[model samples]
Target: MTEPLGAYGSVVEMLEAAATRAPDHPALVCEQVELTYARYRDCVAALAADLARDGIGAGDRVGLLMGNSAQIAVATFGVQAAGAQVVPLNPAYTESELGPVLKDADLALLIHDAGLEELAGAAAPKGTRCLIVGPGARDLTQPTGAPPAPLSLPDPQTLSTLQYTGGTTGAAKGVDLRHAAVAVNVAQREALLPTGPDERVLAITPLFHVYAVAMGLYLAANCGGTLHIVPKFTAAAVLRDIERHRITFLSASPTIFQALLRDPAFAETDLSSLRVCSSGSSALSAEVLHRWEEATGCAICEGYGQTEAGPVLTYNALHGPRRAGTVGVPVPATEIEIVDTDTGLVPLAPGAAGEIRARGPQLMAGYRNRPEETAATLRDGWLYTGDIGRMDDAGHLVICDRKKDMVVTAGYNVFPREIEEVLFAMPGVADAAVVGVADDYRGEMLCAFVVGAEGDLPEERIRAHLAERLAKYKWPRDIRCLAALPKTAVGKTDKKELRQVASVPPSEPA
Candidate 1:
């Protein structure tokens, strides 16, 4: 039987323990700034005290709107330390996109970067207080001349984080995660892919993303390791950081790995220090996997999860046999089964494709103020993950596609990911996505968008490639070549945008 990894009551406690164990150890590094564990803990305690004085405490939702920075990390843990839930928002959101979420969250305070004051003021509802930190504003990472106060620690079930979804399908809903759930997930991930105090982790993704929070932020704190933060992703900068910092662990998306391979510096950069690398947020193509491992001599362990599952469900095991095409077995203390999509009650045998359902300590409490959606998504103590997948005989999970993204052509059902994989393996194809569009005769037709390696790829070439690997029913009726595919905030391909583009009539099918 698998047991829980640690006994921390909350994620804040995890940070405090790390600080006590290694006060002088490096905790965070972002560009020219660095903080020791002792100093980092002091900053968080000071922020918590200030927030308490301002009347922000339990039940208050505090919005953190900013890009990747050391200060954002301080604000995330500090708000929770003060007994309030932290609502991390993507700073890239426009006023229109930020308004509804701000209104829905009913935040008591919003902490944002300097340049976003105008957008925060315009979008946030009246009476919602705003705090700016960054250039020309107060620094969250600095102590405010006040002695640190005793931490307002939370119990296991106390709500700690309110993470908003990407809303690719529709409006984003808040995923409510409690203190124990978030902290336990860090231990769960550590069980599968262990890290040590000597580890140096490079975080290139946005800190607001759950993937970055669990695997990058919390994971580093769990082991008292150094976390190197990058404000933005550029192939050149990432390559330089790994070699400069002697980064040992990297967790990134397949898009980032692909971009790194294309950069000229990737070949010369020293990645010898990298010990464990993980890929998540989207499917990792086998071609990219093979290329990356061959070049770096390091395996890429791809995991699977949604924001509702505390963002991590399964990851390739570090100490055991690692598979190429599977997301690997469930993390410690997690139970997963493939259930029929119609009812989501009957469990299917191995190799049968169905909806992936999971029950674990890492599961979220529910959607915030969305009782009906919570009920529909969580039934009988199981999270009916709208993802479709199958389990192999060895217990490895194979993700097929999302239930909502499945396309029906003529009378047959088709999964776009299967065709997208084939396109990814083709020569001169840099990126690809498949979406279903409304059709008169077939009810729904598949449309494919391809990004080329160098220049515009011939449509006939893509058609010929698909015709040989896929059946007649699976072929996309229309093909389009793009310079680059649109991406969501978390770096997944924006299929909704592609569907909108595919709906428009073209002079001829590419």
Candidate 2:
């Protein structure tokens, strides 16, 4: 493990270097436009100056609500350079969800694109300084205005971002990532992957997601790597874009890999240029990993992180003893402990499966505005990640289950991913939820709400498919099928809504 960079250097060093060394190189790509590094740095400097002019400064929170684009990257860099804390919010967050967060974080500045203009404008704090980045927003591809008076950064430990987490167990809380922590994560990221100044990064993951916020934007910024930002991920489009840019680095989800692997054109793409393809946000199934490696000739290295620890805990190094199922050994400067789930203790044995807990320089200072919750989560300076996993003798980690009441149906943890993965395999199963509905048996009977796919993938056959894989105790006892399963943003099955529909007795055909 490399000694952490204690003598903090300026993040602007990265932007400034790209500006000088690779002035004409494409730094960020979206749609048809590409932003050069020189233009990107100048735009950041200008935007930083603009925010300072708007009364936003170091220690103030600046909210950004938009999809992935060159503007988001520039705005993020601008916020950091201007010495303001960046709060990246998901554009898809409902008004109800978005309201409390802005208030809690005490946001004074906001930037938004058109799709979210209606929701974001309505949510902006009154008298809050604001900037908009959209189709006609700030021609960010081109620098605007004079070089703003540069803002001096505080100590590296100063707050950098208040990123929102998934909040599966409770309301969303802001994870306070300090500049030192983010810098540590990025420095370690660069060490692990070792990219050159000339490499291009194809970033399709949403900028709002903390992984992208830290690893995608900040890491690339720290290394002077060119950023190719895709607003969203589509297999066909990403395939074309990768070849178009000769992209070398990719940060994305397992689903995107599955979609690409399923494509007949996947084999034809020049994915050979991509040296580092990383996946997080969900488990990259061994099956999907195998298929991806076969199709692209590049292995999917699983990196692990959460919003609380400045978003990166462990990443399979580009060259090291990279494990397939485990999230890999702890990163260079991080310490992770997998302990007994219920006992709240670390077991002596190497193969024990337990809750994953970690502490490091990258750890968040704390959650914003939630003391009790913060105390409950951050125990003894260690963030108790709710993920269940086991550590091998080699010190690798393998995720087993979630501590919360949830189901991981086929890699998409059905936080409500549904009773599907559990119930799908039961004997006599049509379909099932294994959900709780004031059940008389076992307090919560494993009920299966199943349906037969019409032509080939029928319910019984699906049950058979599952029976061979899952343990019998985990199988659903009761099965029923509706026309469809409910879903939330990003398309995970809505089990809470399904519980309501399950109350009605299954109808029988005459």
Candidate 3:
């Protein structure tokens, strides 16, 4: 097994070491541009110096509002190198969606894509300064006659990233992760899924998400490997890059994987270069997993995590027996427990279902500015993950569903994941989600929303399929099919929208 990158005070130090180890090696590749490790470090240092000159340092919050590109990657490390907390915002957010976050973060500077300048201006506060950057990071990489100023390296415990949670459940809260925590999580993931210097990582997920940063960006930097960034996700584009770039490692969501499988080009695409693939952000259905692995000959290692736990708590070991339908054991130094959902005090035995709680060095310090929530979530050294799951006898975790997403109808508790899995296995069902809507007699009713492979899906077919697989109570009271399901910024199914839509009367079934 390849050894993990030992230790780093901050993520910036990881980049510095990579640059020193392989100066001329390609570090970042996006579209028509590529930057070597040395050039990548130089761009970060240059941006850091510029931010430092503007009086942005420790205790200041800087927002990076851009899509997945070489420029955003540089800006991320640059802000942290200058000793400020980097807040990564989604450039796709409307001004209304961005306004509350802008006001809440109290940012000193917001570096954004040139195209998003108008949105940034409308959303940012009056005194907040905004810097516009283009696609290739040309402005940051340009040579200045004078040497760049020394970076203001932060203390290990200093707050580094203030990543906001995807608002799938409710309002998005900023997760406060320290420099040491972020660096340690990278090392933790490396311990289980080791990568070498020759590795080529393809990153289609948004860079703003913690999963992308830890698994895609920092993971590549730790090994002095090349990170290929895709600004957007399209089946054709991803398939083309994988074959063209000879990508060895890929980290993406189930939605992305399903799209690739549905594309006509997938059958002919040369995926022989893919050695490792990871799925996160949401659950991966058994049907999709089987199809993908059978076609590509690469097992998709499904993992479980949240933004609060440095975005990684557990992952399937690369060399071990990969279990189907379970997110594998906790990474090194992480302790996980199945606690009773009600009081969260009693520990449950293996094979018993309960809330999953964990404690680890990579855990976030707390949610920013939300003391009450922090106290409730982080207690007795454990982060109370509100996700409901069970630990198998073999120590693998089976995620049932989120606590809030569970349904109680006719006095029977039902997990949406169970029914959704059944839905995913049905032919013509491309994507599926289940939400509990209020009902007068049943207290709450299970409503399933599905996206068909080609056109409108027949509700009767879904009902017939569920009838054979699931219990009568587990069957959805209503089945609605659409062209596409609403997704959160991080590519999670937005159940909140489904619940809202399900509240209204159902139209005639297709």
Q: Point to the candidate with the largest TM-score.
A: 1
Among all candidates shown, the one with the greatest lDDT = 1
Candidate 3 TM-score over all chains jointly: 0.81
Mark the regions of model 3 whose C-alpha exceeds 4 Å error after superposition. 1-6, 135-138, 149-152, 166-169, 405-510
lDDT of 2 at 111: 79
Regions more than 4 Å wrong, model 2: 1-13, 20-24, 125-129, 149-151, 406-510
Backbone clashes for every candidate come to: 0, 15, 0
Residues 65-139 of candidate 1: C-alpha lDDT, one tens digit per residue: 989999999999999999999999978665655787899899989999999888899889998899999988889
Error of 1 at 48 (Å): 0.6
* lDDT for each residue of candidate 3 in 72-99, tens digit (9 for 90 to 100): 8888999999999999997766665578
User: Which 10 consecutive residues of model 2 have the lowest summed lDDT?
Assistant: 409-418
Tell me how candidate 3 scores on lDDT: 0.85
Over the full model, what C-alpha lDDT does candidate 1 score relative to the true structure?
0.86
lDDT of each: 0.86, 0.70, 0.85
**RMSD to native, candidate 3:** 10.5
Q: What is the lDDT of residue 116 in candidate 3?
A: 81
Estimate the TM-score for candidate 2: 0.79
